[model samples]
Target: MADYTPNETGSQLFAEKMWLQGALITAVGYGAVLTLYVLAFYLLLSRLDRWNRQAHAIFLVYITVQFILATLFQASSARFTQLAFINNRDYPGGPGAYELAFFYIPVDMLGNIVYVLSNWFSDALLLWRCAVIYSTCRFPLWVIMGFPAVVMMGSVGSGIMYLLQVSTTSPFLPSSANFTIIDSSISLALNLMLTIMIVGRLVVYRFRLKTNFGLSVSQRDYTSVMAMLVESAGLYAAFSLFFIVPFALGSSVENIAFQALSQVQVIAPFLIIVRVSQGKAWSTSTALEITSASEGLGTLKDKVPMAQIQFACASGDDTSMPNAISHHPSVPNSDTTLTTEVV
Candidate 1:
């Protein structure tokens, strides 16, 4: 409540303000993503069928867990901010120093842990989608996913190390910085590779459709550019670059990007789930269907026949009439008698 300005430089105050701004922006972003999660959850629940119930249930549980982790991270972040700016505002070096010195508090630790967990979930889901999209490719699943799987395991290890390092010391310490950089770089690499794989598969699908079925079919449904972007989780990958680049470069802007990256990660997968619930996402059978349809189009058109039927009614009180049905080759002398009652 007292008007006391700490002896900090203008740049230090500016950096602290950036951190606060990032938190506010993250809160707003979380609200929007939460709305999307609710919509996706409702769609998944309402459209459950015997055929897809098991798959839908698995997704339902996955997204629900993701939502819980994101919610906890956000709550812990808000609590830590409150403690720094209000409860300990009068600490020796001002609120910013208080935040830095107490970064290893329980609430902050929880936020870090959940944030890492959420990232791991999002990355795993993206990798799964990539496998589904590329199911019909000539390469074995292990061949396609092998390197990325190793990198993902490395990411998990680095994330655990990062958490351990931060728990005992300030995140600004050199030891914590090494683990932070390694963890973030691995995550960024994993996301980029998965996004590229997914988008690449969709692009190939589009090309095949265009070549075989014309441009119209290629530009519609799952192969469309927008659909590819959404299904590939491109939004998350792009946002990760925004965060990782700045963080790797030691820029203060990383603070803002870091705050909202987790929410974007969740939003990316939620969008994919929405498409899946709508029956428009790419599936294991999609490539096969496209191939079969392309190969059979001419045969189907040549073999199928069009039929015409004619109905006649008596003008007077007669209730019996004969109907003439005709096929493409013309069925001669084919007629059926009909009886009708007028009410």
Candidate 2:
């Protein structure tokens, strides 16, 4: 019940062919960029010891492998489709076309699986960041995180179902479109909620600090974190929406939108690494003296417990990070009490 025939007018056929080529080109281009980011990540980690480098190295390597697999699958699918169907119009209603309609190509199926897995991993990374930020909250943070976890599970289930359904039928099953739509909707909602929550918590924390110490809190601290959260989630949500619109409408551009979506996933994580590497430097304008013996020293020394700020898995150099007050070039301690100044 579907029209997969491209053997129409010369112009129509040319347009279809060009679209296919464009999708392949775009996917490959993103893969190239992903490779460069991975290379840079490795180079950046060279200074840290193996124990510190393990986490970052593992993350980059996993994503890089997925990118490679996605590229290969896309290329192979395009080649096989052309060789078996588009180029051989003599068999317009041939076995190749029929098989393609009734069943999934291994390459295409694998590519879809990889894309879904990529999204799952990316979402998990985002959730981890949110958890890191709110580790010391008095209220139950895990209880709040539970909502996204449920949504992501549903998304993964829907994605897998959609993949299976497409392979089993032509023009998709009656509810197949619903599965894809649900997946995209869930992804967008999850990312949006996570972004808002993270930013909101940071803003509230800043205000609390301000109230605790007579209005000495720096506005930039909270705002910078908010900006980072927006930048990280904005592109990903936008691309998910773009892909969903075309896909829900069954438009021809859905495939191309998917290619672009994959590219955005790669870009989001790459930006996170770059931002962390840049480091946030806060002003040292405030000084606190613990005792008169230490007065006039201009050295405001406070003991921030190691438990308060935990800068875990940050380029294997967590020990190099200074207190949250000074905003030095070092990584911030993860889940540790970062001793800062009230001055």
Q: Tell me the whole-model lDDT of each prediction, alpha carbons only.
A: 0.78, 0.56
- 225 in model 1: Cα distance from truth in Å? 1.8
Candidate 2 lDDT tens digits, 188-263: 7888777777767656645554454322224443245545454346667777777778767765566566666766
Q: Compose the digit string of candidate 1's lDDT tens values, residues 74-159.
A: 89879988897789877876667777788788999998899899988988888889889878889898999899899889989999
TM-score, one value per model: 0.84, 0.63
Q: What lDDT is reached at residue 50 by model 2?
A: 42
So what's the TM-score on candidate 1? 0.84
Model 1's alpha-carbon lDDT is: 0.78
RMSD of each: 7.9, 10.4
